[model samples]
Target: MFDSRHIRTFHAVVASGSYSAAARLLGYTQPAITQQMKALERAAGTPLFTRLGRRMQLTEAGESLARHAETILGTLSAAESQLKAYARLRTGRVRLCGFPSANATLVPEALSALAAEHPGVQVELLEGEPPASLRRLERGECDITLAFTYPGLHEEVPDEVVEVRLLEDQLTVLLPTGHALARRRAVHLADLAEERWIAGCPRCRANLLHECAGLGFVPDIRFATDDNLVVQSLVAQGLGVAMMPALVLPSLSLTRVCGRTLEPAARRHISAYVRRDHLRIPATAVVLDMLRQVAANRVGC
Candidate 1:
């Protein structure tokens, strides 16, 4: 195979019109230029240059290689420019997968900030719970994922992926306006042990059970749903009480419903997860930074 460096040197010598001139242009000694030309000719299996008086002229083989060199070098130069643009965040794409609440809250804000700072970097968003989002990431369907987990309640994160804690989202107790516990400054899990319960996504349901079990009673969960509005509506009708993350509370209208922090402070940790190798991707890294910036500052980069 022809070495690109040797081809480059061939062009320099042809363009500069002499071995000594090519050496000076290329920052190499005259002897180095001669050696490179010799190697290039051997690879081509024919002589490339001949002297015509004081001038160097291209032989037939030299003319053929030179004709293709322009296309070759142009392609190489264009590729390098694109790589530079990607590294500088001037152009790139990031696929972001997030759950429902985060899509409503952190994901939008972070994405807005990212677009403002990097207009050329495009982003695609997918909404799903942690398990689905993480699975997509593992399958190379996404570049970054926004997910949350209850401490010690969920399975361990995959070894190939790394988690960045964006914020600690406190779980708030949702109750109907007329519910007896709605007036309390804070509600204890034990206080509502016997009330009918509403559960959310799988992880949240697991957390509720884990905490309730610790309090020595099982909840009579009457409803299950992944939608926040559904959970809120159920609580508003006084059908059940539910626990939700603090991040989602503000966007939801509390009409006929109210929220209180758990007495001992149960929290679902919000995080951005990416494969370890993705940390080197500028677009992904930038998105992670923006998420941490817009989050509650409960944690840092």
Candidate 2:
């Protein structure tokens, strides 16, 4: 257990060739420099200096410690510099996890802005739906997670995390461009009772079943996929109808499908989940703020 302060003092003494000279350079009295040297020798479990004529010289152990001191100090100094830079948001890594829609919409905008503002801060992104991303957040696999819950469902967050509601993502029904309800301003869930359905992720599928059950029928789901493109393609081919968040619709080139807002106005609450301890991290804080701003400026959610 060598003290860094003691190691530094020893290095100074070795550099200056005498305790008195080292003390002068370090702005300490000679006695203080001598005491630090003694402490360093005690930590090393060997005598470091021996009197040679009128001057003190390094013993074998002292020479060994001197040989390694500069490298040790260099590593220590670099570590300190990196920590300071991280504290100032000058350099860091922020890991983010998000669902498909939010990743396609909010995340790209927020991350793009973050890159322009903090280029030294590296970012890693993972795509996972609500409970999955939330699990990653709790386990420390990710620093921040963007997750959402439907109108009829709520996600149970871990006690160690804090959830921040960002926006309301309106659920819209996607219909084939030539379908009878395509041109309608809005469509009722019950109106699609006879149509085959394309389900999304597990949570989205569950939300679909929940909303339909409330309207007195179960969706005849024939295709289950989480890819938004697949959902859009199925609807465009007149194969099935699916509910998608309005926020992601703009990002997709939707020439063959018409997305209408649900007649009952269903919406999901999109939120940012972060471990309580991570809120203090500068890069994570910056990323979280950017997400808020991007969500705030968006048309829906």
lDDT of every predicted structure (CA atoms): 0.87, 0.90
Model 1, stretches more than 4 Å misplaced? 296-301
Best of the candidates, TM-score: 2
Clashing pairs in 2: none
Say what the RMSD of model 1 is.
2.7
Candidate 2: count of backbone clashes, pairs at least 3 residues apart or interchain: 0
Could you give candidate 2's per-residue lDDT for residues 43-90 as a string of tens digits? 889999998986889999999999999999999999999899999889
Looking at model 2, report the run of 10 residues with the lowest lDDT sum: 150-159
RMSD, candidate 2, Å: 1.7
Candidate 1 C-alpha lDDT tens digits along 1-301: 7988988888898889999999999999999998999999899899999999988899999999999988888888899999999999999999999999989888888878888998888888888897888888888999888888888856366798988877888888998989888889799989988899999998889889999999999999999999999999889888999988878778877689888888788888787889999999998889888888988543421
What range of 10 consecutive residues in model 1 has the weakest lDDT sum? 292-301
RMSD of candidates 1 onward, in order: 2.7, 1.7
Deviation of model 1 at 93, angstroms: 1.7
